[model samples]
Target chain A: MTQPIEKIETPKGERFIIPIGPQHPALKEPGHFEFTVDGETVKDATVRLGYVHRGIEKATESRNYIQNLYLLERICGICSHTHAMTYSLGVEKLAGVEAPPRAQAIRVIVAELERIHSHMLWLGVAAHEAGFDTLFMYSWRDRETVMDLLELLSGNRVNYSANVLGGVKFDITPEQAGDVLKGLDFLEGRNRHYLDVVSNDALLLGRIRGVGVMTQADAERLGAIGPTARASGVALDVRIDAPYIAYKDFQPALITETAGDLEARFKVRVREIEESIRLIRLLLEHLPEGELVARMPRRIPAGEAISRVEAPRGEAFYFIKSNGTDTPARVKVRTPTIFNMATVLSLAKGLQLADMPMILVGIDPCFSCNDRMVTVREAERAETWTWNELREHGIKVYQR
Target chain B: MSNLVDQITAGLKTWARVNSPWVIHFNSGSCNGCDIEILATLTPRYDLERFGVKLQGSPRHADVLVCTGPVTRQARERLIRIYEQMPEPKFVVAVGSCAVSGGVFEGCYNVMGGIDRVIPVHAFIPGCPPRPEAIIDGVVKLLSSLQSPAPVQPIMGPDGGKA
Candidate 1:
């Protein structure tokens, strides 16, 4: 297969290509990235996704609204609720039915819990990539408390299909609320300790400090989202910018960092984890009381609605167009990882070949999440590129 | 004398393989649920490493392939390439409902059914994304079958033969 969008030519030294995906040990999901290296320095990098694409967007067009709800939940398991919630929120907007206040609060609670599970997962994965296995083990161990809480609230763990068409399927009982509060207390201590550890640990600091740097201007220009942008001081969070569902009632505190390095990204995520714990507690304390669901027709009203939610990785934006039929006209999902890919690719250049893994994992490159909508068929051919031609092409594109 | 020696070496190899199974996980096309659960099994909480099940990076160094997700069109060839790269006496455990029967992803344009369609599966751990405990149970079940008296049949196709 042709390596996509990579060219490196340094006449002084020999350059070789290193393909680090599809089945590489370092990556968890299936996405191909080729780094052109001169000695130990990476001169260029290119990414090819769609290895995890299952025609989800196309599949959504065929299925009805109810079926699409279940299908959409499977888009990215870690942020499954966000996908469902986003889809439901958009569908409800088109149908013009407001979800009950109690249900909206319940959605926010689960969303916050999901954020905690996701960040802890990312922390462990990022740490593991940096050869900090001890921290990885410790973080994952603490992650279970949130996992158990999620499973208790919703029957399932990863893909918590809590959001229904107009409301949520589950509600928090007093007993469950108490358990969640206790869980949050334990998690709060652990997160603080982790915050201290990541900031203080010499080993991690050495690896991540000043690595994969992205400035605020570049972050905005590259269109980075979620914690990745927040780390670079972009200060763009969907929950805060545009409140939806329960977010209006319980607003999230925006967390941002100035460094714009790998360490900055780590800090943003860890701090967000703390923020999520606090949000969950506040939601529990002021738990609303009402019916869990509202009635809506199977066929959604003919209209298009946009839904954007802050997923753990970043913004999960969805555009739903209904044609007054059971099936949707178009269901477009722009996952956070894809929005942050340009930033990752730009960061991959001019770094040590060994440090590439850390940069790639810094944004928690969820290929499954990013490539769920786009499908690219790998052609049977080998394409080559020269350094000067690539630079000239880039310059021309920039000039235009 | 030669036959006896051959049997002894084979027995030793089987015993070694049965004892320590190094795993390499590949997410062909999944929701990240099953993959995380698999990683969780490796951490301190579940600690599948305690059973000598190390999650290796290279396919050549590994004995078992812990496959997750449905076989997508773009990933189909790459999945096959990975399966073919593994050393002999290899086993594949299809973890999650998607790998078993394409689960919810079945009939999607890009989905090509289960992992078994592309690779011979020894055990199918059925769950949307199986819990860490369930994943451990599935791995343990596979190990026990390897030690069973009867031969292990990998691919359960209509032809009913071992791969």
Candidate 2:
């Protein structure tokens, strides 16, 4: 059943309350928005999140630095390496250890590979939201090549646990190096096709051209980063601005667009896939030869540091505070989604309900990664229910 | 006529099992722990379709529900509603450490802890995200259980399946 768009007048003026999420189909995560509209135009928007809060920061305090790498990678699967890399850098700083040049180079390669995978995934999602199912299928199919490369490099597909305290856990052998080159070659070919589809597709252009426009000043003020910020003409990229991992060795191309529309966001991601391809090629050619790991002290001194890496999403921040123990005192991860989600309320105001999902997916907010769960009520009734209770009553009833 | 009817029923159930798996992804309020992993399965790497397991946009079309996150108070009612929307012979696969037993979100205020508190989970896929392969394995296991003639196991309330 569709509810008619209703408007209510306040002391200020007539304002329509448009609910965008919490249960909306547009968002992959669970977050709600109430937009005050005036005749198909958005006057103001209010965002309500914390729907999926899971208390990861609190969970991090109990775990040690080494264990935290695995936990941190869970921040966002699309940009898993950025979390691991940033966390490692923070801990390395506390330990006063520098990763070997070779390790740094490999980190850059994997990180770039992650960017390619993530951006490709976003392209597919954006395409799907735009009702371009073929593009979605094609882009996702090609994304497998990147994932295969990641699997080849680090044994696993998603959370590669490749990054360690002083350096990376895995090393690239001569055979692996050849495999990397071959993977890059295959991706170079597939990317051209992807670019062709994204750049020339008429239907996709019409859907995203002027949708969810964000001005440069507003994007900066709202703390937008990554493709969302770049789409608004922000030239800031952690890889180029700060230069972590092997990014310092080989500079990555910072792709930006001034349009600040959904189309521009699409262009930025597509261009980034190209730049990532370039960065990987450069790293492969100039890869330094040395040990992948560096010797380090067991206990990190009592010090605090913040490290930021340019994830495919945007600036992934990791703040680590140590207290002279293996277990960290505090570890706070401020993901790119947190900043990107802020722009959703603003963008949703002027858009139709149908356009909401496309715009939401455009930011690619990893709601699951950002939200933490909190208990609000106490359990008044307790029954030591067995599996049988579930099988007979709960299972059968819910099943039908 | 009876034999023909049996054949048609078998074919329809098989078609339904492969084509639709009605998924109810529960957040239970996690640190986005298993959420990304679940997303990963839908992405290119694991491409969940080879098994005919498609992520249902809503609970109504879902025959298999996948719940992530710990069971938080805010998500309880919404989770129950989504589960109730699916037709009969549904399977709930709880993914992640949080969904299984609240993982790290156990002591948090907003969370009711494990998902078993609110819904009947047919299978548990453990891990921060339970790796894509593990997710596929869990779904396959659930599918096989659904195909079997044994009675479905309950997750909560008295007279339910034993923990």
Candidate 3:
């Protein structure tokens, strides 16, 4: 059913206000954006997050390391495993214990599988927003293949909770390895079809190409991470740059696209799915043999460690400070979406009202992962102009 | 004759509500897991739509308020606002362990337990992220209770506390 959302015309002047939700249908999560538009062109945009804030960072301070594993996993549903794994990695670093090589390999396997599942889910949602429901249905249907593989290995579908304090919970069996390869085989064919469709489909290309084009310089300056930055040729994949965990052994090729439009972001994600499939197959072949868990102390020594993992959206950074107690003193998370919010707010300026959803999903915004409420001493607010200056300096940026 | 017509129309409303329940989903505070699983049910595989349950985008058009997550401080007012906006005879199905009891987020600074902490819940489906099958079953269970044509009350007490 088509939405009957009415755009009110201000009788005083031509300026119209379009507020897109704390409960609008353009997105699955709640992050409100108000755009002051002139006719069809967007003049200015403002983003208000924290609609889904649950005070996870502060809550982490109270829970012990063992319980916080599951707590942190719920930070973002799509990348729950990445949250748990990243937290465990940091805590392990502080504890001065490395997970067994086999466990590390398992971490990469799960992470890549998650990357595929997440990107596929995003593709379906983005397609649905673009009014192409067929692709949405098709991609989601194919996404189940990877979801099944994840469930087989980790037991749970969404929050795998696979990472233990010192190592992973489950190990891959021969049969599971067979299933992984089988799932990838089916996904490989589907990924190629999707890549072709996103690049060539006339209607899809029209809605995406030359729309929300963020230059490479802009992407870099804005500090966009993951595929959002890679699409603009920024090359900021944390896996390659930092070589965390199994990234050193099973390296992933950085998928970059020169064109930074919505299409480029789409291409970067689709190509990343292809690369994840390749990585999964190789990891399955190597299948390191070792214990899944190492002996970790109940009380971690007093120290601080920062861990970064390449979540499907972008880099998921976790900062853990242990104060010689069972519970951590502070746990800080800087999700990729928070970094891309600047890119999104900037791109939305001067865009048509129709382009807001595309540009918003272009960064694959995850509000729950963000809203952890980190007080950045150095981070400055961009363009805090109230409604007074919103009219005179309502950014007129044109994309060629 | 007037009494008979009134009875028939009320019965029809009950039947229509049970037959096709249009649902509007809200996330007061959730880990996106339950929300995504809820979406998974709408897709072709689980096919909750086969039961004639449509996930409506607006609360105004929805018959059931399907909420996930524990209520958070910031989202409390918005959740209640969405519930209040829906027409009377509305049912609420809170899906997920979090929606049922706040699950892992019970004592967090901003979390206010489950969806029931703010509004009344007609049905509760429990899982870390409940499976699509369980969610379908929960909605069906809620619909089963609405088979009788009693005027659905909001069930708030005189003291503004949960009844």
Candidate 4:
């Protein structure tokens, strides 16, 4: 497997271009990568995305705010709540309304729970990518504990549509609060075990330690964010930097590691899960009392707003513009995966071919979250179309 | 005597296909909700393996093709190619509302409707993303249907004869 894939004679030495994915066993979703290697070491890498592109942002323009909430939530399954929450926050900002304190606290609680589930899921997937099925199975089996808690609270496993326009859809009952606390207790213990395993497991350490090392300067230059950056000693977290929802009141301690390798990424995410558990427990202890939702105007005034939230992967950016109507003029989503993707491609150089999967999953890249736009180039010229032009072209093509 | 031996061998093949189906998952244009749930079904909790299901890495080695989400324009050719690569007597299971009827992504420009729009499906599991248990139930029903002494027909969608 470590053998160079496609050999080509270059000016300096023999070069090899290895194409992976768009359909490959290593990738669960479709994405294409062409990595140029000199022997076993990668020299350059290029990524071609858009296979999972469903034109969601364009589709958002045609739907009203209420409908867009559900549509945007599908941007990512692992971080579905982050998409929904980020969109809701942006739309609420434009409407000049905020959820009540109690609702805000509940939002934070759900957000933290989502972070735990997301991190554990990433841990399982990363372990699986490293060929550690035992760790994968154990982490995922334990992840169901949080999944059941989410199902209990929101009535669905994935895409828990927990947020409404002005506030949340469901309130946490006292019994549900007790159940959440019980679940946290179990997860807290398991997370500690995971932290120990990842930090000390000799077999896993061989694959991850000192592999895919991106220094602090490289991370900053590559624009890495979330745990991928924090693992490299960059302390940039949206919640801590600009506290949204109830994060201001109940702040979770920042966790970072300076190793800047796959091991650091694993440690940071696992420790963050421990932090999430503690934060959720604090929110439940001082559970505020109030209505879950506030009235939102059917027609929001014309305005544009930007909202940023720290999703489990990284900072999820949302841009919303209203045109004095129920529907939005435009909607843009910049997921964290795109920012972290550069780090992986850069780190791929000087590493063994066998380490690519581990390095790729180390960033927790979600291809579904990243694929939003497609660029078509034709005959040395690229044509950019406006809304009207694109509409007309669609009509012409369908008519034909 | 030769005809009798052939009948017994064919019967054994049918029984093995029913008891254990090696499935290969393809994500044409899904939001990742259905894809993850499909993986969850194979994990320890839901444990679809207990029902003799194994997730194969290659389409050629697979007996069933489990597709998620609406088929996209870029992925359409690849989907058909994967379906064609599988050996004879292959089954397709379309999971999720999008795969069955294009759900939320129906009118999206790049999306090409449901999986059935590309390849014929034998079972359709519906949900925003069907629960792992429902996925298991769908696969089980599809396998059990093989017990009958008749060839399985492709489950036709609203617009039939696409296959």
Best by lDDT: 4
Q: What TM-scores do the predictions have?
A: 0.89, 0.82, 0.90, 0.91
lDDT of 1 at A189: 97
Weakest ten-residue segment in model 4 chain A by summed lDDT:
A368-377
Real interface contacts reproduced by model 2, as a fraction? 0.25
Q: Could you list the iRMS of every candidate?
A: 6.3, 7.8, 6.3, 8.4
Residue A102's lDDT within candidate 2 is 95
Off by over 4 Å in 2: A1-15, A23-30, A367-400, B1-21, B30-54, B101-114, B127-134, B151-163
Candidate 1 stretches greater than 4 Å from native: A1-11, A22-30, A367-400, B156-163
The positional error of residue B88 in candidate 1, measured at the CA in angstroms, is 2.3
Candidate 1, position B137, lDDT = 94
lDDT-wise, the better of 3 and 4 is: 4
Regions of model 4 farther than 4 Å from truth: A1-12, A23-30, A367-400, B158-163
Candidate 3: C-alpha lDDT: 0.80
Clashing pairs in 1: none
Superior by DockQ: candidate 1 or candidate 2 = 1
lDDT of every model, 2 decimals: 0.80, 0.72, 0.80, 0.82
> DockQ of each model against the real complex?
0.47, 0.24, 0.50, 0.37
| Total clashing pairs for each candidate | 0, 40, 0, 0
Candidate 2: C-alpha lDDT: 0.72
Best-first order by DockQ: 3, 1, 4, 2
Give the root-mean-square deviation of each candidate in angstroms: 7.0, 8.4, 6.4, 9.0
lDDT (C-alpha) at residue B29 in model 4: 74
Q: What TM-score does structure 3 among the candidates reach?
A: 0.90
Worst 10 residues of 2 chain A by lDDT: A369-378
